[model samples]
Target: MIKKFLFSTLIALCSISAVNAQSKVKETNKLEDPDNLASQYFSQVMGVAVDATSNLKLYKFIYEWIGTPYRFGGNTQKGIDCSAFTKAIYDKVFNTTILRNSRDIFSMVNPLPKDELKEGDLVFFKIKSRSITHIGIYLGDNRFAHASSSRGVVISNLNEPYYSRYFYKGGRILDSVKDELIEE
Candidate 1:
């Protein structure tokens, strides 16, 4: 009777240990999954649904550049300007090159209405100028990523009073334009 009881207790302990180990492995895998981690981090940062961060390349690029100091005509990670940031994202995430300045970039896009804006579209702003002075990459949920002169690299909302007041238009680069740029 003693032997049987000890054997049964040993088996039970081993079974429990096996189950615990399996659960830990599953948790570790979930944590290690790059897509899962990116979705969670970007969803919180962008204030949007997790599914909205489906474009991992775009979000990861923005995430890595967040908090970079704003610089006029600067293009590197140490410092960058709004149009440069937009150009970098297009070149990296979308695999296309865009014009250097905000107004020139605006000319490359097909103008879109505010409500029609989609992820990866360009959101232009007048700011203090009569022409488009600032540009950002739209990240869905009315949020856009840009290098703000005041705030450095940050994600902002279209509905904010400052942005809403100056919001000029949203624009999407047409496939034909992308093809043309690629060929050049």
Candidate 2:
């Protein structure tokens, strides 16, 4: 009878310790996860509650490419142009390949009114010229990320006077290309 009671007590104690250890591990994981941090950062940036799973992949790519410097014809991480940045992002995040220049990409998709823009859409600008010279990936909530000649890779509000004035049209991925853009 005494041995049975002692065994029961030992099992209860071990189970309690296991539960406590699991709780601590979970807390540690939450703190250590880069995705968790990225999600929190994006939530703060967007000023809205971001769904971690739905948008985490997109945010991860943005976070990884943040601060890449701008180069007029550059296409790699060392230095990338606005359209190249958009192309790289689409290729990496959505598994979509797009044209290298802003004009070609702008022509590929159907135009959407500003009010109709959605995440993953492309935003074009006629910066410093009459034709489409710049492009960015729309990130919802009036924010877009691009490789700015002056600022490198950065997120900016579309409502900024400079962007607003230069804004041409927003483009959704073409239906033909949609089949090519496998979700990563």
Name the runs in model 1 displaced over 4 angstroms: 1-33, 182-184
TM-score for each of the candidates: 0.80, 0.74
In candidate 1, which residue pairs get closer than 3 Å at backbone N, Cα or C atoms, i.e. clash? none
Q: Candidate 2 on 1-184: residue-level lDDT in tens? A: 9999999999999999999999999999996888777778877864534555546777778778889888899988899889888988888888778889899998789999888988789899998798998899888888888899998989888999999999999999898777655543
Q: Tell me the spans in candidate 2 whose CA falls farther than 4 Å from its real position.
A: 1-37, 45-49, 180-184
Q: RMSD, model 2, all Cα superposed?
A: 5.9
Candidate 1 TM-score, true structure as reference: 0.80
lDDT for each candidate structure: 0.91, 0.85
lDDT of 1 by residue, 47-69 (tens): 85556336888888998999999
